[model samples]
Target: MKAPALEQRKLLDLQAADNRIAQLQHTLRTLPQEVRLAELQRDSVAARQEFGGVNGELEDARAEIARVEADIDTVAAREKRDRERLQASSSSKDIQGLEHELASLKVRRSNLEDIELAVMERVEEIEQRLAAITARRDDIATEERLLAAQRDEQRDRVAAQLEVAKSERSAIAGGIGAELLALYERQRERYGVGAALLQGGVSLGTNVALTESDLAQIRAAAPDEVVLDPDGACILVRTEESGL
Candidate 1:
C-alpha cells in the first residue's frame, strides 16, 4: 500500500488520539473513588443487616417485658383478693389457706418483677446498640453519596476528553486517502501500532535497526513515496530523521 509521505504521517496523529482515548477510558474505569465507593457500598449493606438484627432483638425484648409485667399484675390482683378474704373470714382453717395462697402469689409477683427488670435492661442495651450502629451506618451512607458524586464527576471529565480525542482523530483521518487509512487501521489491529518513523536507520515501532537492503530500498524511493518496513511489520514514514 502507498500513500504520499506527508499524508502517511497523519497516521501518527490518529495513533496518538487513539492512545489518549484508551487512557481516558482506563481512567474512568479505575477512578480512586470507584474503589472507595465499592467498599462503602459493601459496608452499607452489612450495616443495614446489623441494624435489622438489632431492631428485631429489641422488639422481642420489649414484648417479653410487657408479658412479664402483665403476669406480675395478675399475681398482685390474686394476692389482693386472698388478703381481703383472710380479713373477712373467721375460720382458722380458711384463713390459714388464704394466707398460704397470698404468700405464694407474692412470691410469684416478685419473680415476675425480676424477670421484667432483666428484660427491660436487655431492651435498653439493645436500644443503645441500635443507636450506635445507626449513626455509623448513616456516616457511611453520607460518605458513599459524596464519593459517588466525585466518581461521576471524574467520569464526565474523562468522557469529555475522550470525545475530544475522537473528534481530533476523525478530522486527521479525513485528510488521508481512504485506502491508505484502511491499511493503517488493519496494521494497527494486528500489531497495536500501524505506523512509525524510520529514523536513524531504525524502525521506531520496534526500536530495531533496518537491514542494509531495506535502507537501500528507502534511499532509492522518490520523495512523497511511502515504503513498507523490510519485515513487512509497519508502514515506515520517513522524514529528516530517516538519515537517508
Candidate 2:
C-alpha cells in the first residue's frame, strides 16, 4: 500500500492514542479505590452479621426482663392478699400462717426483682455494644461513600481524557487513505503496534536492530511505499534519522 510518508507518520499518533485508550479502560476496570470499596462492602456484610447476633442477644435480654417483671408483680400481689387475710382473721394460728406465707412472698418478690435487675443490666450492656457497632458501621458506610465518589471522579477524568484521545485518533485516521488505514488497523490488531520508526536501522516496534540485509531491502522501497519490518510486526517508517 502507498501512503505519503507524512501520512504514515500519523500512525504513531493513532498508536499512541490507542495505547492511552487501552490504559484508561484498564484503569476503569482495576481502580485502586474500587478495590478498597469492595473490601469495605465485604466488611459491611460482616459487620451487619455481628450486629444481628448482638441484637438477638438484646432481644433475649429484654424478654427475660419482661418475664422477671411479671413474676415480681405476681409475688407482690400474693403478699398483698396474705396481709389482708391476716388483718381479717382473729385466730392466732391463722395469723401466724398468714404472716409466714407473707414472709415467703416477700422473699420471692426480692428474688424476682434481683433477676429483673440483672436482665436489665444485660440489656444495657447489649445496647451499648450495639451502639458501638452501629457507630462503626456508620463509619464504614461513610468511607465507602467517599471512596465511591473518589473513584467516580477519577473515572470521569479518565473518561474525558479518553474521549479527547479518541477524537484525536479519529481526526488523524480520517486524513489517511482507506487502504493504508485498513492495513495499519490490521497490523495493530495482530501485533499491537501499527507503525514504528525505523530509527538508525532499528525497528522501534520491537526495539531490535534490523540486520544489514533488512536495511538494504527497506532502502530499496519507494519513499511512499508502505513496508513491513522483517518480523512483520508493523510498518517501518524511515526518516533521515533512520540512517538508511
Number of backbone collisions per candidate, in order?
A: 0, 0
Between which residue pairs do clashes occur in model 2?
none
RMSD values for the candidates in order, in angstroms, are 1.9, 1.5
TM-score of each: 0.91, 0.94
- Model 1 segments more than 4 A misplaced: 229-231
Best by lDDT: 2
lDDT of 1 by residue, 122-229 (tens): 999999999999999999999998988888888888899889888988999899999888888888888877888888999987889988888998899886677777
Candidate 1 global CA lDDT score: 0.86
lDDT of each: 0.86, 0.89
